[model samples]
Target chain A: MNAALPILALFTLLALALGLYARRGHDMGLEGWAVGGRGFGPILVFLLLAGEIYTTFTFLGASGFSYGSGAPAYYIIAYGALAYVLGYFLLPAVWRVGQANKLVSQPDFFVHQYDSPALGVLVAIVDILALIPYLVLQLTGLGIIVSLASYGAIDKAVAIWIGAVIVTLYIVASGVRGSAWTAVVKDIMILAIVVFLGLYLPYHLYGGIGAMFAKINTAKPGFLVFPASGQSIWWFATTVLLTSLGFFMWPHSLGACFTARSANVFRKNAIALPIYQLILLFVYFVGFAAVLSVPGLKGAATNLALFKIVIAQFPPWFVGLVGAVGILTALVPGSLIAMTAATLTARNLYGLARPDAKDDEIVNVAKAFVPVIMLIAVYFTLSGSSTIVSLLLVGYSFVTQLFPALVASFFPQIGVTKQGAFAGIAAGVLMSAWLTFTGQSVGKLMPFLPQAIKDFNVGIIALALNVIIMVAVSAVTARKALQPARS
Target chain B: MRPVYWIALIPFVGILAGPVLHNHVHPFILGMPFPLGWVSVWLVITAVLMAVLYALDPANAGE
Candidate 1:
C-alpha cells in the first residue's frame, strides 16, 4: 500500500477523540445524551440535518449511479431540495406536537396522538428493520473508504468492523450531543472538501461545467436526459415522491427534529437545508464529470467510480484528504444511525418491555445496543450481498411503512383504530415485500394511483395500501367514528 | 392562512409542471439545457413558494 497511514491515522483519531469529548455533558442521562436534551438550536439542527443528507452514498454511490445509469442520479440532488421545500410546511406542525407531548421517537408521536402502543411497537419494529439496510449502506461506504485508503493493506471486512466499533463507542459515550457537536465539524469538512474538489476536478479535466456536460452529452446523451430507457416514467416519479416523504420518516431525522429548541429552529433548518442541497448540486455534477473524464472503467465494482477517479487522477495527498472526507461522511451518519437505533431500542422496545426501567438503565441499554447494531451493520457490509442502491431501496421501502400511522396520528380525525393501523402496516409490509422480491417496481403494481400514489417508491406503496386498509376497516367497524353525525 | 401549507405545494406543482412543460415546450434557462432549465426554474419556484408560505402563516415567528 503506497497510502499515507500517518495522515489517515491522525484524522481518524482526531474525529473519534473529538466525538468522545463532546459526549461529556450528554452522558448525564438518556434524555440528555440521546436527544441532546431537546435543546438543539438552528446551527446544531443544520449540521445534524446536513450530516444525515450527505452519506457515503453522496461521496461514492451518487457518482457510481451517474456513471452506471445517467441523469437519474440527479434525483438525489433534486429530492433533497424537494424534501426541505415540503418540510417547511409539514415540520412546524410536527414540531408543535413534539413539543406539546415530549415525543422521543416517531413512534412515540404516533402512539400518543392515536392512543396506540401496538401501533407504536409496529412502527418501532419497522424502523429497526428498515434501519438495518440503511446502516449497512453507511458501513459499506466506510468499508470502501478503508479498503481504498489502505490500498488493499487492510481487509475490507476488518476495516468496516473497526469503523463501526469506533462509531458505536462514541455514540454510546455521548449520545445526541456527541452527534450534534461532531455534526458541526463534519458538515464543515464535507462542504469544504466537496466544494474544493467539485470546482478543481471539472476545471482540471473539462475546463468548465458546460464543457463537462457537453462532453458527456456527446458521448452519453442518456446521462443528460430524464426517464432514461429501462428507467420507467412511473419509477422516476414515484422514486422521487417516496424518497421525499421517507426523508423525514428516517429515525435519525426524527431524532434531530426532537432536538430542536423550538419550532422556529426546525423552520430555519428547513429553509436553510436547501442551501446545503444547493452546495450538493456541485457534488452531483462531480459524478457527471467522472463519466466524461473516466469512461469505460469496467468491472462488477461500479461503486468505485468516484474513488477510482480520485486515486487515479488526483495527487496522493489530495486523495488522502478526499479519503478522510469520505471517512468523515461515513462516520457522521454511522454514529447518528447507531445512536438513533439505540435510542429506539432503549426508549420504545426496552422501556416498553419493562416500563419501570430507570432512565440511566435505558441509556445504558442504548449505549450497549449501539455496538450491537453497528456490529450487525459491519457484518452486512463485509457480506456484501447487495449493491448500495439495492440496500438503500430496501431501507427506503421499509421506513416508508411508518408514514400512514405517523401522519394519521397527527390528524386524529383519520379515524384509524390501532387494530386497523396494525393491519394496514402488516398488509403494507407484505405487499411491499412481495413487490420488491418479485422484481416489480412499486409504481407498476398500482397503475391507477396518482403520480404521488403510483410513484410510491420503496415501501410507500405498502404504506398507501396500509392506509387504505386502515381507513376501510375503521369505517366498517365504527360508523359513528367515521361519520361524526349531524350537528 | 397557513403560509407553509401553500409554500409546500409550490414544489409539488413545479414537480408536476416541470416535466409537462419540458415535454411540450422545451423550456430553457439562459440558453442552458432544459432539464437543467427545469431544475433551476423549479428550484426558484419552490423557494418563492416557501417564502410565500412563511409570509402567509408566520405561525412560529412569535414563538
Candidate 2:
C-alpha cells in the first residue's frame, strides 16, 4: 500500500501550510521577504541558521561518509563546532554591519564594504553559481529519499518535481520566514528520529554502542581512526579548517545571519548551536551501525545507510515517518538556498543593470526568480548533468575563495582595494575549477611534495593563492593610491 | 580583541589536535570511537566555553 508515500505527501503539505501561515502578519516587501524585516529574535534566528547549516547533506552525506570512509567523517562534526565558535564573534559583526547598512543579500556586504557595485556583481555571480549545485544536490537527495522510503513505488523524477514546486510555492509566499517556519518542524522531527535510530540500531544489532565499535574494529581494522596516509590526520585537520571558514561564506548562511533583530541573538546562538551540532554524532552512529548490520552499500549507495537499515528492521509506518523527516530536511534548506539565489539575482545582478528599478519592481523580480531557479535546479537534477555534479564537489572551495576578501573587509589596515579583491577572487575561483576539472589533488599536482603535505585538502592551496594574490595586489594598488595621481 | 576572548582558542586546539593526540581507536570514551568521542567531548567543551564567554564579555552584558 506504500504508506511511506502518503506520509511523505502529508508532511510536505503541512510544511507548505506553515510557510503560508508565516506570511499572515508580515509585510512581503523586498526587505521583508529577503531578511524577514531584520526582526527575528534569538530562537527564530537559531533555528533558521540551523535550518540552513544542517541540510539533506547532513542526513545523507554525513552518514554516508561515515559508512564509507570511517574516521574522516569526524571532520564534519569538528568543522561545525568550530564554525560556530567563529560565528560567536563573526556573525554578530555581520549582523551589526547588516543592520546599519540595510544589507539584505550576502553580496551587498562586499558591495558596501568595498564601495564597489562591480564587486557585488562578481559576488552575486559566484554565489548563484555555487548555489545551483548546492540546490541541485538537495533536490537529488530528496528524490533518493522519497523513492527509497516508498519501497520503490514512486518515481525519483516525479518526487523531485513535487519537492521543487513545494519549495518554490512556500518561498515565493513567505521567503525567509517560510524556511524558518518549516525549520521549526524539521529540527524537532530530525532530533527525535536521529536519536532514536542512532540508539536503537546499535543496541538492537550489536548489543550496545561499545560492542558495535569493537566488532567493527575487529572486522575492518584501522577504519575507526585516521590512517597514516591518504585521508590522514593532516587531511582531517586541514579539511576541517577549510570547511569551517567556508561554512558562513555560503550566501544563504550569511543571509540567514541578517534575519536576526539583535547582534546578541547571534552571540546567544553561538553558545547553543554547537550543542545542536552534536546531533551529527548520532548521525555518525547510524552510519556506523549500518556498516555491520546492512553491508555491501558501495559508492553512491552508501548514502542509503540510514533508510536501508530502517526498512529492513522496522515496519512501513515507521519508514514513512523517517521519509517524512527526510523530506523536510531537503525542503527547508532548498527553500532557503533558492530564496538567497533569487534575491541575489534580482537585487545585485538585475538591479545593477536597471538602476532605475523601483523597490517594488525588484521584489517582484525576486519572486519571479524563485520558480525560475527551482526549474533550473529540477532540470539539472533530472538530466543528471555530470558537469554540475562535478562542480558540486568544488562548491566549498569555490566559495571559500571569498573568505580572504571577506575577512580583509573587516580590517582596513590590510588596505585591500576593490581591484585586488576582484582579481584575487577571480583567480581563486579559476584555480579551484581547474584543479577540480583536471582531477588534480595536491599529490597529483606536485608529486615531489611530502605525503603529509600532499594529503592536505586542495582547497587550502586555492585559498592560499587567494590570500597571496589579494595581499600582493593590495600592496601594489595601495602604493599606487599613495603615489602621484596620474591617469 | 580582549584577553578573555582568547579562551575561544581552546576548542580549536583541542579538536584539531586530534590527529596527534587521540588518533587511536582503543580507549573509547562513552562507547564511541577514539576520534568520534574526541570530537563529541570538544563539542561540549565548546558550548561551555561559549557560555562562559557570554557571561564574562561586556558586549553581551546589557542584553
The per-candidate count of clashes, in order, stands at 3, 0
- Write candidate 1's Cα lDDT for A274-309 as tens digits: 656766656766776678666775443667778777
Q: What does the TM-score come to for chain B in model 1?
A: 0.63
lDDT of 2 by residue, A384-434 (tens): 733222334567878888998888888877688877888899889989888
Every candidate's DockQ is 0.38, 0.82
Q: How high is the DockQ of candidate 1?
A: 0.38
Off by over 4 Å in 1: A1-3, A227-229, A297-300, A442-460, A479-487, B1-4, B23-33
Evaluate model 1: give its lDDT. 0.72
Q: Which stretches of candidate 2 lie over 4 Å from their true place?
A: A385-392, A479-487
Kindly report the root-mean-square deviation of model 2 from the true structure over all alpha carbons.
2.6
Q: Cα lDDT of all candidates, in order?
A: 0.72, 0.87
**Top TM-score hit:** 2
Q: Is the docking of candidate 2 incorrect, acceptable, medium or high quality?
A: high
Could you tell me the TM-score of candidate 1? 0.91
Clashes of 1: 3
Give per-residue lDDT, candidate 1, residue A117: 71
Candidate chain B TM-scores, in order:
0.63, 0.88
